[model samples]
Structure formats: structure tokens, C-alpha cells
Target: MIVAFDFILLLFVIICAIAAISVKDLLSAVYILGAYSFFMCLLWAEMGAVDVAFTEASVSAGIGTVLLIAAVSKTKRRSKD
Candidate 1:
């Protein structure tokens, strides 16, 4: 049961990672990347790596995301299209 759930979570994380890369919009991509990082943290926690998961959550999903959003907000929102 847990294996199946972890597999599904991994799949979703992969999808989010791909979406984050392929999306045209920057903010959407950043948010999707954050979600991907969060899912990774979840997987780590599930695998009994609470320390690693906490670090990932605090850095990638927390501070990194905030930095990205701040940087994005300082620049133009739309692409040249």
C-alpha cells in the first residue's frame, strides 16, 4: 500500500518537474518546481530521512521559492510573445 502511494507521488513529482521545465510562464514554472521539491521532501520523509526532508522543505520549498518569487516580481511578468 505504501509502495503504491509512494510510486504515485513520485509520478506526480516527475510530472510537476516536467511541467516546470516546459511551461512558458516563469512564475507558474517556479511554483511547479516548488511543488516538485515539496513532493521530493515527502518521499524522503516517507523513506525515514526526516533530516534530509526537513532541509529540502526549508531550503527548496521555502527560501528558494521565496527568492524566486521575489526575483520574478522585480522583472516583467509576460514573455516577449
Candidate 2:
């Protein structure tokens, strides 16, 4: 059951990463990247690295996501060449 949970988390992280990189909308991409980081934190916790997981969760899922959202809010959501 633990292994299954890890596998699912890993799969979600992979999908979120792909979406973050591939999305055209900047805000959506940033949100997806945040989601990816959250899953990574979960992965770290599952692997028994409590300290690293705590740091990752606080930084990536919390501060990082807030910063990214703030940045996105201050700029245009789409880029044009």
C-alpha cells in the first residue's frame, strides 16, 4: 500500500511537470509547477526524509507557489513574439 501510494504520487508529479512545461498559459504553468513541487514533497516524505520533506513542503508548496502567483498576477498571462 505504501509502495502504491508512492507510485501514484510519482505519476502525479510526472504529469504535473509535463503540464507545467507544455502549457501555453503562464499562470496555468506556474500553478502546475507548484503542484509538481507539492508531489515532490510527498515523495520525499514517503522516502523517510522528514527534514527535507518539511523544507520542500514549506518552500515549494507554500512560499514558492505564493511568489509565483504574485509574479503571474503582475504580468500578462500570455507571451507573444
Which candidate comes out best when scored by TM-score? 1
Query: What value of lDDT does candidate 2 attain over all alpha carbons?
Result: 0.87
For model 1, residues 1-81, the per-residue Cα lDDT tens digits are: 279879988899889988988888889988998999999999999888999999999998999999999989999666643
Off by over 4 Å in 1: none
The TM-score values for the models, in the order shown, are 0.87, 0.84
- In model 1, which range of ten residues has the least summed lDDT? 72-81
Best model number under lDDT: 1
Q: List the residue pairs that clash in candidate 2.
A: none
Q: Count clashing pairs, candidate 1.
A: 0
Output candidate 1 Cα RMSD.
Answer: 2.0
